[model samples]
Target: MSVRAQLFAASLSALSLLTATGALAQQGGLDPAKLGLNANENLRALAGSSNTAMVFDNRYEGIKGTPYAIPRWLPAKLALTSNIPVASVLLKYDVYKQRLLIRDPSRPDSLLLDANKVTGFALTDPSAPDVATGQPRVRQFRRFAEAPVATQKAEFVEVLYEGKYSLLRRYAKEMEKADYKGAYSTDQRFDELTDKSIYYLRSPEGAVAPVKLNLKALQAAAPSLAPALKAEGSKRPLKTAEDAASLLRAAEGQ
Candidate 1:
């Protein structure tokens, strides 16, 4: 095999080991007893629930940097028809190959969106108390992804927010019912439930196969994983799915 191929194999091996260690730690499944009891149980609990099956074929892209800049090709294809303030849009494209490469912070790139291009839109509230003055607080509805020319891949509409639970619920509900007419033909693939669970599995050649666990296990491990979680908090320490993925990627790299 070529040197490139060997590196690929090594990365896969590391990924496999990371997954295996995670699975072994979750052998007993999501145990409430393991995580300290707290009133936030509804948010933290993930035991004895229906096994939510996920299609692993989903792709992801890493959108990093302070001022975000999405590729015109992919972002133009995402359908943002929901009439709600988008909290955060989660795209699952392959980040390794398609990281939205950050430009010079002093001279960041910008993509303009025409009225016809977006399905919906919103602007940040200027009247809102200045949490971080001088930081650009404008919010806009941008595209996320599109279906292949032949395949019927669904476009996900993620709502961005910066408020408490009531505000979250209000916007989430509006997004759940918004009419999404994107590259994808149907809404069957769209998920509206804000509190759904998902999981992933990993394997490496000639290595021990590992079991699988979902977000529940991570939540179960949160209280105990406080130290790790706290130390890594600055680098997106487990608030969002993308943050959690970053944490896992960092751990796997080590």
Candidate 2:
């Protein structure tokens, strides 16, 4: 057999093995506890795709911090370009590479999902608890065309407050390299991932412009809520993402 044909056959074989475990995945996503698949095998299958898999491995080996926005995998619902939505996937957003990572119960390596296939995704916040519901908060993100903004089309923008006037956030991560001057010197040993997010306000007509995290910019983008924002700012701080979302809720009389 030809080399190309052999490679194609190998890819198909690996994928078929993964499909064998699809029954477990259908029983409400790939639960961590029920995973019987091997981690190495899973990663090999994920990387088996030719020119279709999302980028793999960290650019910097042995880096101190992870490339993901949050290191932990959270339950996510994926909206695919094919219009078929996939749910119950444990996902991680790699802010550095601007790609999504999927977790397998038995695998140490995450499956780099093909970004071209996914239009957007919704992730339940693992860290933040909703004060109103006393449960974990959920955040939604959409890609370039779905959530048009003045940035890379492949980038995912967080819909912090979706309304007539919407609020969006784009995460930009920078790697702070190791600063080890000498063995005797007291300096850091590992590179860290740092956040430098950019915020935006979308007009009712869907025009998006970058804005500051402060109230003035937000209120300027949402003039109707200016008075309410001013009043609330006086009572407390309008300096946080929570504050901004709260004011937006207040503006809508929610």
Candidate 3:
């Protein structure tokens, strides 16, 4: 063969070898066996195993699975359970003897038990106009008198509010049974049912000012309950007398 032809054949062979090597590299050149990774390490390569374990633990070992979790809290919150619209707000005394049945309009079979009773405060018909709206038909809490309802949703959407209150009442009853004082109080400060005496008017800067209450008289009547009454009175302004009167009853004969 001529030297030029021989050189051409050698070049063609080298090109073929290079093409074959590139094809092999693309195919499976990165074998794990060559990399010294064992089967156990390979198993650890699977995604979400740790995440799955965390989820499993959270599901079974957390607040969701405890006895107090499902029936006491969940039943009252979920839509599938007893759902009723709040026809009206009632005080603990008003609800004490009365059997307030919360029936699910969707499921007649599902009715909530013992939802009406309330303590520490109650909702009453305003004896006079709201200082703001000057309308008696509007509802409000005697205590925490800023606005009868905490959120606008609780005011307009009766069912949602009622459902929330139902759950709250359930929790409250549990607390009362367990003697949890904090349960009766709330960060909200104002709710549908509140002691009238414990209310105050909201100042321009959002400070609480006690409504028209003869503190001297309340103090004279019951010295021990005075501090509690005063604290309660200061939470929200009882813009009206009816609100104050409800609170006054607690101090009577003190």
Candidate 4:
């Protein structure tokens, strides 16, 4: 196991003990001993791990919406750059900051995994099903060095429909600072995380471009696929991401 993997696995053993003293606790109550590592190495790895050291008091205190892709942490499968594979990782994606937050049972504060070292990651959303498949939605994300749209700000995008003409969901979030200007201001008092996701469509020639979740945008993204989009989209409402994915499938299949 790699150094990072060892640290992540060993943190669970320290989770309960740390929480007993109110030092730090894992994101979710996960069993660390299940990792089955040498006791001495576990301690060593725990000490070597980086604790965020940055804790916000009353985190998200009175915030209207969360700054995470998913408000709660989920088990994720991460693909690291150096062939390091860590399964069942308890982590959260902070879309606002584009940071990968990892939970360490041993630490007082959650650790932030270096997003740069992550080549790709997969998250499963229990509520949503795959657009093309009936199975649960496995939202996969990866960083593209060169993209059809501006990716400098947000590096990772959700792969929705991958085919000759692929569709991607670029998540964008902005913290709407609390606008409570004294007691008389009519503005909202709590901070909010606003979602402004941008969609992209990739051509067969391998050019990805931003496309809105509508027939017009899809057609504009690829003039050649306009007829197919019109015929298929008219049959269904482009109301959700799944609808858009279905439409993309039609265009690609035709």
TM-score of decoy 4: 0.67
RMSD of 4: 21.3
Clash number for candidate 1: 13
C-alpha lDDT values of all predictions:
0.34, 0.77, 0.34, 0.76
lDDT of 1 by residue, 1-254 (tens): 99999878866865665566557558956454533233244333323256667666332222222222222222122334454443332222212222222222345463333334345333343433333465434444332223221221121223232211000101111113323347764533343323222222211221111112323443344334445534555565355534454454443442
TM-scores, in order shown?
0.20, 0.66, 0.20, 0.67
Question: Candidate 1: lDDT over CA atoms?
Answer: 0.34
Q: For every model in order, what is the number of clashing pairs? A: 13, 0, 12, 2
TM-score of 1: 0.20
Better of 2 and 4 by TM-score: 4
Q: In model 4, which regions exceed 4 Å deviation?
A: 1-61, 104-109, 131-133, 148-154, 182-184
Give the runs in model 3 whose Cα sits over 4 Å from its true position: 1-37, 45-209, 212-214, 217-254
State in Å the error of residue 101, model 2: 0.8
Better of 2 and 3 by lDDT: 2
Report the lDDT tens digits of candidate 3 across residue range 19-113: 66556656867564533453344445433247455432221221111121112111122121134433432222222222223344456353444
What digit string (tens of lDDT, one per residue) describes model 2 on residues 72-108? 8899988998997555789998989888889887887
198: Cα error in model 2, Å:
0.9
